[model samples]
Every structure is written in C-alpha cells, then in structure tokens.
Target: MMNDCSLVVGGSKGIGLEIAKLFSERGDVTYILSRNKGKWLGNHIEADLSNERNLNHVLHYIRNNKIRFKYIVFAQKNRSLPDDLDYELMIQLKSVKILVEGIAPSMEGGAFVFIGSPSGRFIVREQPLGYHLSKAALEHLTKYYAVNLGKFGIRFNCILPGTVLKESNREFYQANEDVSNLLKRITPLRMFGEAMDIVNAVDFFSSEKSRYITGQVIFIDGGQSLEGQESLARRLTFGED
Candidate 1:
C-alpha cells in the first residue's frame, strides 16, 4: 500500500517547479532535488547536481528510503558559467547520467522526461557552444537509455522547448512588446507557450497514456521551430512582409 513516488531534479524554479507542482497536486509522493530548498509542498532533497558528492548523497538517501519512482523529470540547467564547458557538461549532462544509472534500477516501469532546448539541433547565438553540445548529447542519451532500458520497462524521452513564457522571463517579454509581437507573427501558433504547456506534456509522458511511447523528442514551442530561419531573421532585421 505504498504511495506512488516521483522525482524532479532541479525542481526549485521555473519549468521544473511547475512540473513538480503538477505531481504534488496529483497526490504522488513527489521529491524535488535541487541545490536550494524549494517552497513547494513536496520533499526537498538538497543536492548540487554539479557536485559528485552531493549526487552521491542524494542517491544514498533514495536507496535508504527504498523510494521507487513512478516518474523522474530532469529540468536542471547551469547558465552561471555559460562559457565553462566542463561546468556546463557536468550540470547538464553528467548529472543526468549519474542519476539515471543510479536510480533506474529502483524504478518500477516508469518514464524519464528530460527538459531540453531546441538548441540541440539549431544554434542559439545567445547560448554557449557547451550548452548546445550538452543538449544535443542529451537528446541522444535519451534514446540510448530508452533502448537499453526498454527490457526493464523504463521509458526515456526528451522535450525540446523553444520560446516559452515562464516566470524567469515573463517580464522581459511583457516589457518588450515589439519583440513579443514579432515572435507572435513568426510563430505559426501566433503566441508564446506557457509553463503549463510543458507541464501538460510531461504529465502525458509520465502517465500510462504514453506507455508505448519512448525515445521520442517532442517540441512544445507553439510551432516556432517550424518557422524559416531566414524569414525570422528578416522579420527581426526589417519590417514584416
């Protein structure tokens, strides 16, 4: 009669926090793993993903508690040292590898959803080379784990998001009406995605509805990825056609 459990890495803020909230509301025993303690109503495991010792401590805690996860989401990112390749790799990729390998054995046929970025395939000038490289590798890593862990009934998938309106950058978008309008014009959906947009997708992947789905890369960008690069650049540089 154990309660269903879920874990959200980097669930202290932004999209991660939203995802964690969804699980908490659904009556799951949700755990938020992050460097700082989250204000949400869930079990908080303080761990810096970049630090191996911190990760080890988290693993040990979970093992000791015998927590079998029904859903595991990775929404962590390190932008403090954008140019530091090692730091970016450690936070964005290595931590995921360590946790997945360490916890997959305890999972009783659940899903692992990675929150990635469109930078995985396209170059985002604002982001560093390491960010793009780590994200690209994360997509592949999702497929790799899905293939290798299928026998164990674990599913792995990645969600690559484009421009989404979250708490972190909501003000920026609101203040820059011109930029927001331009984004709307270029995107097929003619709107920016919200945090709930991502939460819904994660919920789907975590539920039994997506039991047959795995190793898939889904984008929830309001069709922004479908826009032509040249057209977008032209719109940004000049007036829209």
Candidate 2:
C-alpha cells in the first residue's frame, strides 16, 4: 500500500521475478526490464542486458515517464558460463552499472539491491570462472557506489543467496543429488532456501525499516558461506598433513 515506484531488472524469471511480484502485490508501480516478458501480468520493458543501447532506452523511458524510483533491484541470473569475458561482464555487471547510474539521479533516497552470490565473496572453484569473477567485481562495485552515492541518500547493498530453489533451477537441483545433499549437509539450516526467502530480504531493505543500513553485503545463504570456508580450510590442513 506504500506509494513507491520500483524498477526490477531481469524480472522475467527466478529471483528477479519474485522480487517484482512482491512489489506488484504491495501495489507499487513495478516496471520489469528484461529481454523476455514473463508470465507475470505487470508492467514490463523488454531490454537485453547485453545491449547497451537497449539499456539506454530503458533509462530514457524511465526519465521521460518521470518514474521516481523508491526501489531498484538488480537480480539478473547467469545460468550458463560464457566463453567471452566481455559478454559475461556486460550481462552480470556493466548493464547494471549503467542502469544504476542512469536511474540513481532520479531516486528520492531509495534503496538499490543487487542479488549477488556467495561466490563473489569467497573462492568457489566449482562455479564458472566468469560468473565468479563478475560477481566478485559486482560486489566491490556495490560498495563503491554506496560510498560515492551516500551523499544523495541512495542506499546500495548486496544480498548473496545460497541455493535458492526456483522454477528454473528445480531441474538442476533434482539432477545433481550429490551437490544438493552436500549443500544441505554443510548449511546450518540443513535446507535449501526458497525464492521467498530472498524476497523477504529485499522487502526489508526496500522499506524504511532498514533506513540506516547501506554499503553492506548481507548473505542470505543459511550459513553456507561459512561452511564452505571451513571445508576449504580443512582440505588445506589435511593436505599439509
């Protein structure tokens, strides 16, 4: 019921869609920018993150429409590893950077949430190198903006999700029984998180409830990052022995 305008990038599926749904349900003017129009019957702007011109168009559309944003969420998901570094960075980081810079000026002290990964903070060898690198850089960039843009009262933060079960990832988690079991076993919660879990985090940050928090990287990963670091340390210790 709050008067807010939100722009959700990559809102076609997975985490982005869930975030957009939350905004729509709350009666916010939610604009989804994605290449594919999701089944969600809400406002949508079809734009490819890899295309800078498309991103620029979205920025102009928002500006021309005078959409003053209260929340901006970057929830783009990279399911596959790309061979080209430029393409990978473009999708994962560059496009988001442009959108944030473009829209930040119009924000009235709102929050910008980036859906990041645990791989960004830690060394996760099993993940695609390009994705890991891009996320790591994205996380750093999140902090950079937080420092630079705090004067304007725009909050920038990142949420590092663990294995959040989504329609897109259901099949992969089902197929990789070993990986799923290992993830559950290591996590203190002993269960994979659902999309709602992440949406809740975004909801908090987007509201005045978290007005004082910014430049922080919060992990909603059920302690998976801690477990991963512990496992890595143990491996190193055992190798020396």
Candidate 3:
C-alpha cells in the first residue's frame, strides 16, 4: 500500500510553501514543483513551468516514477514580468492546463485547488491588467476541468484569496500600519488572513469532507469581499467612518 501523493506547483515559498507543509505533516508523499528549490519536507522538482522543455521533463518524470497524485495545487505566479500578458498567461493558466491534462490520467481520485486572487473578479489597481485577465480565466479553467474530469473521480476547485499575509509580503504589511489597519476595518471579519487560512481551505478541499464538492470557487478573504468597492475605497481614503 502506498501513501497518498500530493503535488504543489510553485510551492517554493509563501502560501504555496505552507500548503506543501500541510501535506507533508499529514504524511502524504509530497512533491514540490518550482523553479527554485523550496525549504520544505518534500521532493523538490526544480523546473520552470514557462519553459516548454522543463514542462515536458516534469510530466515525464512524474509518469516514469508512477506517482499518482491525490492532491494537486497550482500556486505559480509570474512576479518578474508583472505587465507581460504572455508571461502571466503562461504561468497562471497555460501551465495549469498542461500539468492537469498530463497528470489527470494517472490520478485515481483527488482534488486540484487553484490559488487565484480576488482580483479575478475585482480590480486591484496595484496589479497589472494581464494579472486580472489570467486570474479570471483560471476560474473558468477550474470549472472546465471539473466538468470534464468528474468521471475520473477527480475534483477541481479555485480559491480566491484577499489580503492574506505570507512570508513574502509579511514585512511589508507589518510595516504599513495604516494600510493594514484599513484592510482589517473594511473586512467583515475585522482581521487579516494568514497563509494558514488558505492552507486550511486547501486541506478541506483535498480531504474526504469535500468528496461531493466540485467546480466551486471559494473566497478565503476574511469576509473582505463582502464590502462594496466604493465603501472600501472610502474607508481607505477617509480613514474609516
């Protein structure tokens, strides 16, 4: 009998890394696929998803090893070229499509959770247009795969996170007291979410608890999405009511 296998794409750092850690802690045979090696308790496959050759190599390695993934997470983001449409599309959407198609055949039954952004539906001025487009498309991709792959007992879902603090942006958020406090005030939960919050949602989706759930888009934003944009903006500009 083999232990359950899990794959975390772009798991080298931040929320992705936290998700990988969760799987490893639960005794899953975890694999981290990223351009750089992550400091985590798992097998690290250093490959750039944007490179066609690297993508092929990753698929081949998984197949050759007969690794059957029970949970797959897509957390890859193109931070280097924020304004490049092609780069954003390739990392956020194309890579997910290719990897899922390649791995779905071997998966017995499991879930694929996409780490998307609230900007998928809402506009974040700080982010580029390409980022918004790619994220919006990713939501549909999740649903598309869910509908087609249901016969294989594989579930697909997307998670849209808002203002979640992680390793990469923790210092920035901690230092910016005004912005941080404003975000908390606008959120219905009155708090900023942590990386573990997203991890918990991923864990739920991958576990038997969500066995009957599929094609769902969950927002792990500490209820930030509940507030209207105008209201949020007013709060940001006027320092709350």
Listed per candidate, the RMSD to the true structure in angstroms reads: 1.9, 3.5, 2.0
Tens digits of per-residue lDDT for model 1, 1-241 = 7767999998988899999999989888999998786566668988888798889988999999888898999999794788999999999999999999999998779999999999999988999999999999999999999999999999999999878998789999999999998888888888899899999999999988999999999999888887678888887678764
Q: Pick the candidate with the highest TM-score.
A: 1
Q: Rank the candidates by lDDT, best first.
A: 1, 3, 2
Candidate achieving higher lDDT, 1 or 2: 1
Which portions of model 3 miss their true places by more than 4 Å?
A: 230-241
Better of 2 and 3 by lDDT: 3
lDDT of each: 0.91, 0.85, 0.88
Query: Model 2, poorest ten-residue lDDT window?
Result: 232-241
For model 1, state the Cα shift of residue 168 in Å: 1.4
Put down candidate 2 lDDT per residue, 2-97, tens digits, no spaces. 578988888888778889999989888898888777776788888888889988998898889888888999988655546567788889989988
Output the better candidate (2/3) by TM-score: 3
Q: Per model, how many backbone clashes are there?
A: 0, 0, 0
RMSD over all Cα atoms, model 3 = 2.0
Candidate 3 — which pairs collide? none
Q: Which ranking of candidates, highest TM-score first?
A: 1, 3, 2
Q: In model 3, how many backbone clashes occur?
A: 0
